[model samples]
Target: MRLLHTMLRVGDLDRSIAFYTDILGMKLLRRQDYPEGRFTLAFVGYQPESEGAVLELTHNWDTASYELGNGYGHIALGVPDAYAACEAIRAAGGKVVREAGPMKHGTTVIAFVDDPDGYKIELIQRD
Candidate 1:
């Protein structure tokens, strides 16, 4: 079966949305609020959800922060140029935790950036 989407619980929905959509150059595919569940979900990605996997940002009405426990790792995105992507992310007020460089023990260039909710996103350069 094909993979669907990755869900991340964000403390600030708006901030997270901006980070994914504005800073990372992703599109907000859809968003919905569940009043009864007291939560909201927003899907974002580079392409349509039907075409590829996307990211789901979940925001609970009562929760303002998350610990992001140890088990959670970073999400990875393929880019044309890791260096350029990192530079653009930094110019857009995004946090670049790791500078663009070749992966350890490998030649694949990569970089890391943190979202508004402190979620790490890995950028891998692709030919």
Candidate 2:
């Protein structure tokens, strides 16, 4: 079976959506509010959900933040140029936790940016 979307709990739904859509160049696929559960779910991606996996942003009405435990790693995105991606992310008001450079002990270039909710996104240079 194909993989689906990855879910992340965000403190502010609008801010998180702006980071993914405005900074990361992703589209807001869909969003729905669960009134009974006091939460909202918004989906975003580079393509249609049927074409590839997407991201699910969950906002709980009563929760302002979450502790990102050590178990959660960053989400990776393939880019034509890790350096350019880092620059663009920074220009778009994103936080670059790591500059673009060859991965430690490897030749592959990589960089990192943090979302509004402090979720890490890895940019990997691809041919």
Name the top TM-score candidate: 2
Clashes of each: 0, 0
What are the clashing pairs of model 1? Answer: none
lDDT per residue as tens, model 1, 61-105: 999999999999999999999999999999999999999999999
- Per-residue lDDT, model 1, residue 108, is 93
Q: Write the per-residue lDDT of candidate 2 for residues 94-118, one digit (tens) a residue.
A: 9999999999999999999999988
Model 1 scores a TM of 0.97
